[model samples]
Target: MYGVDACPNTEEPPDLPALGTLLVDTSRNNRVGEFRGGAGCYWSLRPMGGGTEWEVEPRHVRLALPIEQLRARTARANARSRGDIL
Candidate 1:
């Protein structure tokens, strides 16, 4: 999964997990998956326990941005939030 998230059966969908973390609870039978570039997340449900397990993707796509550009964007957004532009 590129950008993955969880969906609790009773509540709204959630954001993805950070690096080296297990996002799903083994106790649940169903959940959701979210992609970074997609329009929205997806749903995945399975029979409860001890039948078959799907392997999760180990790697995700990460973009490379110039430090200057990133800083510039953050500065612009912060300034815009404060009603200042320079």
Candidate 2:
């Protein structure tokens, strides 16, 4: 669910697309999606008996990696930048 504005340091703030929400069904955490406008990213946690709604905060979202995992993710991101693979 990467977008124009998702990478603020590389792209101008004005170029960021309209913020969107992301919903997740409990069964398949491997898949993701997006939405535009209010509540940019939302997820349903523990949907067995009742589902709890969680929204991803725009300010806190990031592509950060732990020091131990930095090398791998950086290499991956660099490779992704070279193509539309990400």
Candidate 3:
């Protein structure tokens, strides 16, 4: 839809979370990420503190709980304070 011709999308992508949302791969080891967008059957997400991006199936992700969100944000803040992230 970006005016650039895209490939014939497969049988509709699953109901995915909105962009910039925090989610964790419930099917995996609770990997936290911010939903970016989709690529074919997979969705792209960046880590909480902003590192490499990853792809996940919609079925694997769920919205991060309040506690999880707090922890992630806190961890990122701590990392920033420690200068581990710029």
Candidate 4:
């Protein structure tokens, strides 16, 4: 009979950032995005300028630096001003 202990995962899961926290995806040219949630083994990120979300491995993600965060916020604001995003 199959049981929970039959196929236990040995590796610890990656720690997830708080929702809405800014993060940088190194695998995606250091794109800055907000942490939306996790999708199985990957994490979902939403662009700061408000676009479709993308998923990335947790190992490839890191907390956005202060400057990066500022830039993302500014870009979002600009997009909003131009009516590119609501």
Q: lDDT of all predictions, in order shown?
A: 0.34, 0.34, 0.79, 0.88
Clashes within 3 Å, all models in order:
0, 5, 0, 0
Residue-level error in angstroms, candidate 3, position 70: 0.6
lDDT of 4 by residue, 1-86 (tens): 54743423336658888999999999999999999998667789999999999998888889999999999999999999999963
Error of 2 at 23 (Å): 2.1
Sorted on TM-score, best first, the list reads: 4, 3, 1, 2
The per-residue C-alpha lDDT of model 4 at residue 1 equals 56
Winning candidate number (lDDT) = 4
The regions of model 1 sitting more than 4 angstroms off are: 1-65
Q: Which ten residues in a row are the worst by lDDT in model 3?
A: 1-10
Cα RMSD for predicted model 2: 14.8
Leading candidate by TM-score: 4
Off by over 4 Å in 3: 1-12
> Per-residue lDDT of 17-85 in model 2, one digit per residue for the tens?
333323232334322223233322332222211224343334333322244134434554666676633
Clashes of 4: 0
Model 1, 1-86: lDDT tens digits are 34364422334435544433223323343222222222234323221211233433322222223553354456546766777633
10 residues in a row with least lDDT, candidate 2: 42-51
